[model samples]
Target chain A: MPLFDEKVKTQLVQLLSKLTNPITLHFFSQEIECPTCQTTHQFVEEIASLSDKISLHTYDLVKDSDIAKAFNIDKIPAIVVSDSKNTLKGVRFFGIPAGYEINSFIGACLEVSGAKEPLPQPIIDRIKKIAKPIHIQVFVTLT
Target chain B: MEITFNLPGLETIEQRTIPLDSSVIYDVIIIGGGPAALTAAVYCMRKGVKTGLITLDVGGQVAETSVVENYMGYNHIEGISLVQRFKEQVEQFEIGFLQGYKAIQLQDGTIKKVTCEDGNTYMAKAVIITTGKRWRRLNVPGESELTGKGVAYCAICDAPLFKDKDVMVVGGGNSAVEAAIDLAKLATSVTVVQLLPHLTADKVLQDELSKFNNVTIVYQHQLKAIHGTNSVEAVTLFDSRSQKERTLNVQGIFIEIGLVPNTELVKDVVALNHNGEIIIDCNCRTSRPGIFAAGDVTSVPYKQIIIAAGEGAKAALSACEYVLLKK
Candidate 1:
């Protein structure tokens, strides 16, 4: 059975049809000790099939050590979303993007596809002056 | 637990596009994603006012609720599901959304400025602060001393840490009862300490609490202090009716009495009541011109979802008129 129902799939198709650029979803997962790895991978694949502009690339965290390192993936069931030019915009999902997080995932994809920064111009200008690499980790719960 | 392929019905295929003009100032910027904030966004968007919504999470306190039956148009629905519907409706408009960011401060000026924790600032002609309330603390002794040690606010987040250990829940509202029910599944024993003479939650929740085997409900008892050396080991309670005090040996204490308004961001920028709730007029206008407040964060009489939504609409319409007048 499909993860998304026909109604949801149709809605996604219509939503993704307006994508101006293609988006790639890189999924990292491993089979051992990972409960939702397979399901998350399958969910991404199912979502990718809804629109031609969206593509899914699967990687085994254990076997594809080099690929995982390149993407800075440290955990299983991770997703890295990039724009049409394959440039990482620091958009990532650490676990299964189910529940309300799905909206954030899709919103990230649309933002990356459009190649537009959601921040206001003054904020973007201030961000451009950052001289050091500052990593921001936002802790969130599935609920 | 078995991994199921069930898709969460709380999600929608909603997508929003950011405006290409980076320098454009939105007519209104809403600082929440709950029923009130989303309703304001919808109303503002329909009025052709450029709106932006910034929130740490979409559902606010509603998402943490187990079930919602009081909201109109639905006999019963999960809190998260109802929030998803609100989100879907709001996404139909061309409003800018900055999710997963916490608004740290609000600066009042000719154009209001909202500074987020993500190091981004937003400008708007009108601002509506709907950031709802959060879990209220017991404010008893040892609560602040051992927050992470044992006293917790979120049962869902910390329940697994107390597996097989006895825990106590404070408060008699829906959140407290629901937390007791949820903790009973994992904890060795669950005791509920409520100050009221009777449980204030719905009869349905009260009925569900009665079915739990390892749950104890103590009424008319006030939580005087939390007791522990390194962690939460016990809690001291005062009996209001009997004029007696007692202590229950428990490893964890979950305080869910109620919530206090999330008005810190605007406390200095606008007028606030003694309870730290933003003060708003009949039109949802704050003392500061071009600023509005709504939802649980405001000094509203009721904190229901429908009431918040209605207030949000009013704030948005008022904001629209305010912006037009300035033009």
Candidate 2:
């Protein structure tokens, strides 16, 4: 049997097909040897296969730092969901999006696509108000 | 009456049979199988490292979540679904996962030899302890007996199962607070029972919890006993200071008191902090040179899935470095 039931697959496919805007799922995998990245990539592939609007962009974080830097992606297995013109400025989902949360994520994507006004005031304010691109570095000793 | 091998001639002829000092080595020995360990296995195999994972469970506590809301992408997901996805990823990468085996002792230095409960032994040049911790049980009656019915360790894993049901969460930490808040979304009412007078969780979580009208926090209370014959039907708690007894008619209880590190296997071999967490540097190196640890078992702050996965990657990278340097 398939890992996901036919019902779940059908539901997810339906969910993605109904998306109002183009969703570009970007993944930054540094160590392809790392297993989480592989899974993350697979998840992205599954979602991509289900929908025409879903585009998967994978970058080797170790090799393409500039691309990751531009996208504000520092870690591996990080996914950025964007709009029709591939504007990376949207709700960014970190880590794997599996389980019941996938439905909500799909809902959020649909909601955010046509939404001109903020749904959650806090998250919108955090997304809209862009401070200067800041780099943080820290050094500490074990006390 | 047991027979013994008595080779007197060979035993007496101990004329310096040159002992060859040798150590066992592994290409990739993962310490955990949670998101981090399994993910590391996939990475190591993709990088052409002989990968093997030694973990207590496949999904860790994250699997116990009733519903996952904030893990990006999915607005809501069952904990089992997330774990299944993780497991599928590991299997796809051809990673060797030791099911039902716990890494008890790890001897570090030149070579790594790990022993499990089955007496099966493995040698590795690199060792990563992904053995995560277990949630501290309530240790009260009806707690273990009614686990699946109502007593749960994770709200994300089981909250969906309790839709429109009354839920009770024990403990005052961030996990307990978060569980109550998460359950409040699905359940009709969520009651939080805390042993202390005040919550120990961060102010943010406490403040956010206050916003939920369905939530009620009961302070200075301890779970006296869980009641229910078939499934969890109600819970009894005793006021710590007043010693007054109070029972709440509830359908579910999520125990988020705390976690105890699964360092028992390597307790004697590695240095543990006061909390019994394995002591490790930022590089994921334990007190022993060849041995490394990551995830909840280590002393790293923040036990989120993303953070654990990151730490697991660091541990594997560090293990690779140790192998290169030693060789």
Candidate 3:
């Protein structure tokens, strides 16, 4: 029934089990002529079934324009994962995070869900060293 | 157009533009609009940091992709589709996306300043450079005229469409070899025309190519012209050593020669390697502070989709951490 096979879903579930906090996956999509939107939904749902901590929330970008406006979601198949505290930590995964980095995305979600920020000793020392709010502007070109 | 988000103690939010030399202060300003810029925007926005992105176009090279089978999720997807999805996600936040503008200059110190092409300027605490590279052209006649008709830069998107048809790959590098091997599996025949005397690809790919009978490797050859009407019909080659010319009957041409880093804007200001690649540390931090580079533009060894996205994520995370320290 799904484009992705059961084996992939099983693997996603296995990864979801290792997560320690609740991750709310907010999916913003449209209905018509939208195949990838459905596919993204299926992937999230498959992963959702693996853990109680993971929840799937859907918002129609066209129908629920207000909600879409709130999240600034203008396209379909956009996902936003937030921790239980309602603070947004992660971002929209453009296209799909498939292949090798999917595992790293899961890791980011787990880290964000835990909502723990431990500053490195060097960074803390650096922050203390600064007397004012320092602004750093970096310019990079594609090479 | 500016949209203001309501936050405590943020009473009067004004929409204004500043000149580059006016000494306006900013926390951070980013240039370019590809994966690196988008990821940086997300990270900075989440930290409740003020950030700005300046660029004329949004998607960069990723926008031209027809099918992204390797970037992840779904068996396949159009390149524009993925970029639109990314744009939608960025729309949710209050990140300043200065569209229709190009950054022309950069400066150092606590407050950095960047001048745009239109004479508008913005200052920031830090800057992240995510401008991706541009694929070099074959420079052969008809290659440009028949681009969409038969010439393509991506193998994954055009390979399937050429099933049972004859295809030609031009280049001596790993990308060309891998594409030829992949096309050999689908097309009727695959001919690799290289400018070098021999294959310059890794030994593993050269050995793998040896197993494919449908593939023919032509050394010391270069594409001189592409013949076609509405689509590609044939390709002309010139022998470098003998100075002789030959023609092959083919319908498609995949140019895998190489890519030129899109570093024109920042070349004079930043330190670049001999190949024009921006040299960065392990964390995607560029030679200059508040400036980070990622993806194919950097001196990273491997150039793959997974590696680019991983580098993009790292650059974003690092930008986020950098902003927190500034605050």
Candidate 1 CAPRI assessment class = incorrect
- Return the top candidate by lDDT: 1
Query: Which tens-of-lDDT digit does each residue in B1-327 have in candidate 2?
Result: 111111112222222211111233457677666876866776676666666776656888777655667666678777767777667656655555566556677766565777765456777777788778888897999988998888898665567778899889999999999888889889999999998889999999999999999988899989999999999888888987887898889999999988998887789888999999999999988888777888888899877777777887788787777776766
Indicate whether candidate 2 or candidate 3 has the larger TM-score.
Answer: 2
Better model by DockQ, 1 or 2?
A: 1
10 residues in a row with least lDDT, candidate 3 chain B: B3-12
Tens-digit lDDT track of model 3 for A1-143? 65335555555555566677788878787766376676677666766677899888877888888877776677777877777655677366654445544655576677767744444444566679999888886542221
Model 2 residue A66 lDDT?
Answer: 88
Task: Name model 2 segments beyond 4 Å from true.
Answer: A1-143, B1-25, B46-48, B62-95, B104-110, B117-119, B163-165, B185-188, B201-208, B211-214
Best by TM-score: 1
Residues A1-143, model 2: lDDT tens digits: 22344555666665555576676777777754476666667777776788887778888887888888888887777777777676866566666666545644666566656534223333456667877886666442211
CAPRI grade, predicted model 2: incorrect
Candidate 1, residues A48-139, lDDT tens digits: the string is 99888998888888899998898899988899999766688988798777665666777788888894545654556678999999998766
